[model samples]
Target: MGEPVARIMVVDDNEMNIRVLEALLSGRGYTVSTAHDGEEALEKIQEEIPDLMLLDAMMPRVDGFAVLKKLKENPKTRLIPVVMLTALSDLDSNVKAVELGADDFLTKPFNKALLLARVRSLLHVKFLLDELESVDEIIAMTARIVEAKDEYTEGHVERVTAFALGLGQAAGLNEWSMRNLRRGALLHDLGKIAVPDDVLNKPGKLDKEEWDHILRHPEVGASILKGLKSLASVVDIVLHHHEKLDGSGYPDGLKGDEITIESRIMAIADIYDALTTKRSYKEGMSKETALRILQEEGQEGKLDERLVNIFSQLVERGEFESLGDRIPNLFNIPPPPPR
Candidate 1:
C-alpha cells in the first residue's frame, strides 16, 4: 500500500493566509483543515487531532502562542508537530513559540516551496515518531505475554515498573533516564520466555541444572532486545538487573559502578516485587519483610545502598499507595499465616 496522506491543520485568523496554506498543502496531496483562530483550532484539535499544525503567531484572542501552550500541556496533543507561522520581524514571538515546544517555524509571506518543504519534513518526523510509539506498544505487549506465562505472578511487570519509576522519581533522574528505567523495568524479565515452562513453573526448588537455565534469562532477554535501536537505552537494565554490587550476581557479574544506575534502580524493584509476589512453593511476604530483606541486601553490598534507601523512604511515605491501588490485583496478595 502507498504511504498514508498527511493531515495538516492551518490555524490563522486571516482568511487569506489560511487559503494560501490550504492551496499550497492540498495541491501536494495533503489532507488540509483550517481554523480561523486559536480557539477554533483547539476545538477542532479536541474533536480530531491533526498530524501537524500550522499556527499563525498573531491571531485575535487566542493566538498561536496560547494554542501552543495548551497543546504542549495536553499529553494527547503534545507530540503533534507544530510549525509556528510568524511575520519577518516577529523574532521574539518565534523564540517564545520555540520555548513553548513548537517543532519548526515558517515566516510570512509564505514561499510555496519552503512551506511544502517544512510541511514534508515535519510530517516525516511525526511519521517516524508514530512508528516509534508503535514499537513501544509492541515491546509492552511482548512483556505482557511473558508475564502471562506465569499465572502465579501476574501484573509483576507493571508493579516492578511502577516501583522503579517511583524510585527513579525520588532520585531526581532526568527524563531520558526515567523513560529508559520504565521500559527496562517492564521488559526486565522478557528473557524468561526462553526458559522451559516446566522449569519456570516448577513447584519444587530448582535443581542446579534448572537454576543454571534460569540464570541465563537476563542475557537471553538482553539479546532479544538488542536488535531494536529504540530499546538500546534500556537494554543494559534488562541484562544487568541481576548483577550485584559485590560481583556475586550472574550473567556478566558486573560489580559496583560497572552497572548503570538504571539497572541498579531496576534491581531494587525487581527484587522487591519478587519477594512480595507469591509463587507455587512460597507465599508472598509482607511489605515490611520485603523492605527488611532489601535493607539487609543493601547492607551486604548486593543492591545500591542509596537507591534502596530512597525506595525505603518512598515506601515509608506511602508514595506507592496510589499505584498499588490502581493495580490492586498485583498488590492484593494475602499475607501468609503465622507459624
Candidate 2:
C-alpha cells in the first residue's frame, strides 16, 4: 500500500493561526481539520481521531493544558501525538507541556521549514505508534476470541490484564512496565489457540492427554508471539507464566527465583482471573475464596508473596472492582488471593 495520508487537527482560538496551520498542513498532503478551542477540539475528537494534534497553549473556555490532560487520560486518544503551538516560548510552558504529554512544541513566530520538519517527525512517530497499537489490538481481539470460544472465560483476558497492571504498579514497576504487564496478561493464553476445540471446550476435567495438550500452550503461544518482534516480551510471558516459585509448575517446571518478576505477576493475575471467572466445568469462586487461593499459593511458594500480598490489598480495598467492570469476561468482583 502507498504511504497513508496523515489526518491533522489544528486547535487554536486565533483565526489567523488556524488558517495558516491548516494551509501549511493541507499543502503537505495531510488531511486537515480545525477546532477553535479545546472544547471544540474535544467534540471533534469524538467524531474523528486525528493522526496528530497541533494545539495552541492559550485558548478561551478550555486551554491547551486542559485538553492535553483529557487526551492523555483517555486510552483511545492518548496515543495521538500532540504538538503545542503558541507564542509562549518560556521554560515553564515547555516543561508543563512535556509533563502533560505533548510530543513537540513550536513558537508562534514559526519557521516554515522547522514547522514542516517537526510535523514530519511527529507524524513518523505517530505512524510507528499506530502500527504498535494495531498489533496490540489484534492480540487483545485474539484473546477475546479465545475467551468467547471457551465458555468458561467470557472476561478472563481483560480482568487478568487489570490485575496484572495493578500488581505491576504496586511492585514499583514504571508506567512502561505496567503496560508491558498488561500485554503479558493479554497474551498469556495465546498458545491455547493450538489446542483442539474439543479439548478447549470440554466441560469435564482434563484427562492425561488433555492435560498434555494444555501444557503445550505456553510453548505454542511463545512460538507464535516470538515470530512477531513487536510481541517479543509478550511471548516470554506466555511461555513462562505457568512456572512457579517452588519448581512445581509445568512447561519447564521453572521454580523460585528462576521466574522473572513479569512471569510471576502474570501467574498470579492469570490464576486469580481464572478462579473468579466462571467456566463450563465450574462456577466462579467467591471473592473471599479467590483471595484465599492466592494466599495459599504464596505461602506454598508457588507465587511471589510480596506481589500476592499487594494484589490482595488492592482486592480488599476494592481497587480492582472498577477494572473488572470495564473489562469483559471476568467475574464482576476483585480477584482473590491464592489460598
Candidate 3:
C-alpha cells in the first residue's frame, strides 16, 4: 500500500503564497487546509490538528514565531510537526524558528519536492513518537497494578517514580531512559510478594538468615516478572535495585555501571523512601535525616552521586512531603527541613 496522505495546513497572509502551497501540496495527494493569517491559522488548528503545518513567518497580530511558540507550549498541539515558511532566509530567522521548535524551514522560493520530502520525514517521526508513547502508557498501567497490590506501598510507586524521574531528568537522561526509570521505580519491590508475611512485616530487626532471605527478593521478583512480555525491561530494574555500586549488595553482587541508570535512580528513590517511611519494625526516619544518610552512604559509591544529589534537592524543595501521607499519617513524623 502507498504511504498515507498527510494532512497539511498552509498558513500565509498573502493569497498567492497560500494558493501556491495548497495547489502544490494537493497535487501530491496531501489533504490540504489554507489559513489567511496567523489568527485564522490558530483557529483552524483548534478545529483540527494537521499532520504538518507549513507556516508563514510574517503575519499580522501573531507572527510565525509567536504561533510556533504557542503550538509548542500546548501539550495537545506540541507534537504536530511545523515547518516555517518565510521570505526572511537570514540565519537569525532560521535559528529563531528552530529554537522555537519548528521542525523544518522553507524559504520563500521553496522547492516543491523538498517541501514534500520534509513533510513526509517529520510526519514519520511523529508517528514513531506516538507509537512509543502508547507503549509507555501500557507499561505504566501494568506497573500501577503491581503497585496497587500492597497498600502500604501503594503510593510508594508514584512517589518513588517521581523521585526517580526528577533524578533522571536532572542527570540529563533521555526521554526513553526517564520512562524506563519510572517503570523500574514502580516495579522494583515486586519481589517482596515472594517473602512470607511474617518476614516482610516483622516488627523486630531481622537476623542474619532472615536478612539473607530478604535480600533475595530482587532476584525472586525479577524472575517472576521477567516471564511476562510487557514487563521485560522492568525485570532488570527489579533484580538490580538492591545491587550496590561497590559490589556489596544483593543476589548477584553486580556493581557500578553494570547497573543501568534506571536501576541506579530506582535505588536512590527506593532506599530514601525506605528510610523516611515507617515499616512494621521501626518509625520512619525524618526527611532531614534521610537526606543526610543518602549523601553520606551514597558517597561510598553504592548509589549514583547525581541521583542522590537530585533527591536531596527535591527533598529540600518539598517534593516528598505528601509522600509520608500516602502510607498513612500513622506516624507523627517530625517537621521536615525549612522549604
Candidate 4:
C-alpha cells in the first residue's frame, strides 16, 4: 500500500504564521490541524493525535516550551515528532528547545526547502516508530488470546498493566519507560500459551514436572519478540519479571540491580495480582492483606522497597483504582472471540 497521508499539526498564536504553515503542509497533500496557543494545541491533541507537530517557540500564557514539555511527558502524545519554530536564533534557545524534546528546530523565515526536508525526515522516523507500535499491538492481541485459554484468570493482563503503570508513574518513570511497562505487563504471560490447560489450571500446588513447565514461560515469552529492537525494553521486563533480587527466582539467577526497574515493577505487579485475584480453588484476598504481604516482601528484599512503598501508598490513598480507569490502553487489544 502507498504511504498513508501524514497528519500534521501547526501550533502558533499568530494567525499569519498558522496560515503559512497550513498552506504549505496542505499544499503537499498532508492532513493539517492548527492551534493558536499551547492550551488549544494540548486540547486538540487529546481530540486527535497528529502524526507530526510544528510548534511555535513563543506564545501567550502557554508557550511552546510548556507545550513541548507537556507532550514529551505523556506517553500517548510523547512519540509525536515535534519541530520547534522560533524567531530566536540564539544558541541557548536552540539548546532549550532540544532539551524539552523538540525533534527539530528552525529559526523563523526558515527556508521552505529546509523546513519541508526536516518535516519529511521526522515523518519517516515517526512512520517507522508507528510500525513498531503496530507490531506491539499484534503481540498484545496475541497475549489476550493467550489469556483466554484459562478461565480462572479473567482480566489478569489488564489489571497487571494498570498496577504496573501506577507503580511506574509513582516512581517517576519517564514517558518511554511507562510505555514499555504497559507493553510488558500485557505480554508478560504470552509464554503461558505453551503450558497445557491441565497444568495451568491445577487447583493444588504443582509437582516438580508441572512446576518445570511453568518456569519456561518467561524465557519463552522473551524469545518470542527478542527480534524486535524497539521492544528491547519490553523483552527485559518479560524475561526478568520472575527473577528475584537474591537469585532464588527464575529461569535466570539475576542478582540485585541486575534486573531493570521495569522488570522489577512487572514482578511486583504480577505478584500482587496473583495474590489478590480469585482462582478456582481460592477466594481473592483483601486489599489490606495484599498490601501487607507486598510490604513484607519488600522488607525481605524480594522486591524494590521504594517501588513497593510507593505502590502501597497509592493503594492506601485510593489513588490506585483510578489509575486503571485513567490509563490509556494503547493498541486497543480486541476482546476474546465467541466460544
Candidate 5:
C-alpha cells in the first residue's frame, strides 16, 4: 500500500490566503483542512488532530502565537508540526513564533516550492515521532501488564515516576535529564518480566535463590535497554537505581559519586515508593516512618544525602503535582533519540 496521505491544517483569517494554500497543498496530493482563526482550528484539532498545521502568524482573536502556545503546552497536540505563515517577517515575530514552539517560519507570498518542502520535511519528522510514540506505548504497556500480574503493586510505575520527577525537579535537573528520569522510573522494573510469575507474585519473603533472582533485575533491565542508543542515560538509571552509596547495593556494586545523580534520585524514589506501598508480604509504612527511614539511610550513606534531603522537603511542602493520575502525560516530554 502507498504511504498514508498527510493531513495539514491551514489556520488563516484571510479567505484568499487559505484558498491559495489549500489549492497548492491539495494539488500535491495532500489532505487539507482550513480554519478561519485559531479558536476554530483548536476546536477542530480536539476532534481530529492533523499531522501538520500551517498557521498564519496574525489573526483576529486567538492568533497564531496564542494558538502555538496552547498547543505546545498540551502533550496531546504538542508534537504536531506548526509552520508560521504570515506577512509579519520581522525578526521578533519569527523569534517569538519559534520560541512558542513553531516548527518552521515562512512569510506570506511564500514560494510554493519552499512551502511544500518545509511541509514535507515536517511531515516526515511527524511520522518518525509517531513511530517513537508507539515504541514508548509498548514499553509502558508492558510495564503496566507486569504490574497488573501483582495485584498489590498497582500504580507502582506511575507513582515512582511521579516521585522521581518531583525529586528530579527539586534536584535542579535540566529538561533533558528530567525526560530520561521519567522514562527510567517508569520502565525501571521491566527486567522483572523475565522472572517466573510464581516468583514475582510470591507472597512470602523470598528464599536466597529467589532473592538472588530479584537482585539481578537491575542488570537484566539495563541489558534490555542498553542497545537502544537513545536510552543510554536511561540505561544507567535502570542498571544502577538499586545501587547504594555504601557499595552494598546490587549487580555491579557501584558506590559514591560513581552512581550518577540521575540514578541516585531514582534510588531514593524507588526506595520511598517501595517503603510506603503495601505489598502482600508486608503492610505499608506510614509517611513519617518512611521519611525517617530515608533520612536514616541518607545519613548512613545508603542513599545520596543531598537528594534525600531535597525529596523530604518536597514531600513535606507538597510542592509537586500528582502525575500518577495523568498516566498519559506521565512521560509528557516525548523525547526524540537524544544526541
Candidate 6:
C-alpha cells in the first residue's frame, strides 16, 4: 500500500499565503486544511486535531506565539507538530516560537522544497510519537480492566491517584515526579488482578497461604508493567509501595533511601484511601481515625513523616474532599474534617 496522506492545517491571515501553502502541500498528496487566524485554527483543532500545523507568526487578534503557548499548555494539542511561518529577519519571533514548543520554523517568502521537507520530517516524528502514546493508552486500559474486576474496589485507583496528586503538590514535587506519582498511583494495585476473585472478595480473615498470594500482588503488578519501556520510572513505585522504612514490610522489604520518594508518597495515599474507603469486609473508617493511623505509621518509620504531615494538613483543609464526589462509589462517604 502507498503511504498514508498526512493532514496539515495552515493558519495564516493573508489569503495569498494560505492559498500558496494549500496548493503546495495539496500537490504533494497531503490532505490540506486552512484557517484564516489563530482563533479559527484553534476552533478547527478542537473539532479535529491535524497531524501538523503551519502557524503564521503575525496575525491581528491572536498571534502565532500566543497560539503556540496555548497549544503547548494543553495536553491534547501539545503533541501536534507546528512550524512557525515568519519573516526572514524576525529572529526574536523565531526564538519565541522555539520557547513555545514550535517543532520547526519556515521563514516567509516560503521555499516549496524546504517547506515540504520540514513537513515530511515533522509528520514522521508525529507518527512515531502517536505510536508510543497508543502503547501507554493500552497499559492504562489494562489497569481499568483490573479495576473493573471487584465491584467493592470500584474507584479505588481514582481516589488514590487524586490523593497522591494532592500530597505530591503539597510536598512541592516537580513536574516529572508529579507525573510519575500520578501514573504509579493509578496502576499500583494492578497486581491484584492475578489474585483469585474468591480470595480478593473474601469477607473474613485470610488464611496464611491466601495472604501470601495477596502479598505477591505488588510483584505481580510490577512484572506486568516492567515490560513497557515508557513505564520504567513507575515500576519501582508499584513494586515497593508496600515496603516500610524499617525494612519490615513485604516484597523486597526496602528500607529508608532504598525506597523512592514517589513510592513513599504513594504508600501514604494508598493507606489513607484503603482505610477511609468502605469494602465488603469492613466499613469505612472516619477521616480522623485514618489520619491518626497514618500519623502512627509515620512515627513508626513505616511511611515518610514529612509527606504524612503535608497530607494531613491537606486533608484538614479539605483539599481532597471534592475528589470523593468524582469517584463512582465514594460519594456516600462522609467528608473529611475541616481545618
> In model 4, which runs have C-alpha deviations exceeding 4 angstroms?
7-28, 31-115, 321-339
- At residue 82, give the lDDT of candidate 6: 97
Which pairs of residues clash in candidate 6, taking residues 3 or more apart in a chain or in different chains?
Answer: none
Query: Candidate 5 at residue 207, lDDT?
Result: 98
Model 4 agreement with the true structure over 256-292: per-residue lDDT tens digits: 9898999999998999889999897899999899989
What tens-digit string does per-residue lDDT give for candidate 3 at 27-90? 8788999988788889999999998899999898889999999999987788888999889779
Which stretches of model 6 miss by more than 4 angstroms?
A: 1-5, 38-47, 59-62, 73-76, 328-339
Distance from true position, residue 239, model 5, in Å? 0.4
Task: List candidate 2 stretches off by more than 4 Å.
Answer: 9-21, 33-50, 53-114, 203-207, 276-285, 318-325, 329-339
Compute the lDDT for candidate 1: 0.85
**lDDT of every model, 2 decimals:** 0.85, 0.83, 0.78, 0.86, 0.86, 0.85
Residue 5 in model 4: lDDT: 99
Q: What is the C-alpha RMSD of each candidate to the true structure, in Å?
A: 6.2, 5.6, 7.5, 6.0, 3.5, 5.4
TM-score of 4: 0.73
List candidate 1 segments past 4 Å from native.
Answer: 322-325, 328-339
TM per candidate comes to 0.91, 0.75, 0.67, 0.73, 0.83, 0.87
Against the true structure, candidate 3 reaches a TM-score of 0.67
- Superposed by TM-score, candidate 5 places the C-alpha of residue 47 at a distance from the truth, in angstroms, of 4.6
Local accuracy of candidate 5 as per-residue lDDT tens digits, 1-339: 655899999999999999999999999999999999999999999999999999999999899999999999897888899999869668899999989989999997899999999999899988977777776777677678767766667888888888898888878998888878878888888888777778888887889998888788888989988898767878888988889999999878898989998899999989988999888778999877998999999999999889989998998886544554576676444654433
Candidate 5 at 266: error in angstroms?
Answer: 1.6
Error of 2 at 20 (Å): 4.4
C-alpha RMSD between model 1 and the true structure:
6.2
Pick by TM-score: which candidate is best? Answer: 1
As for candidate 4, its clashing pairs are none
Cα deviation of 110, candidate 4, in Å: 5.9
- Candidate 6 lDDT, tens digit per residue, 1-339? 644679999999999999988999999999999999989998999999999999999998988889999998887788899999997657888988998899988787878898899999999988877666565556566768888886778788878878887888888888778767777877899999999998888888999999998999999999998888778898998999999888988799889999988988999998998999898778999999999999999999888999999999999999888875666633222211111
Better of 1 and 3 by TM-score: 1
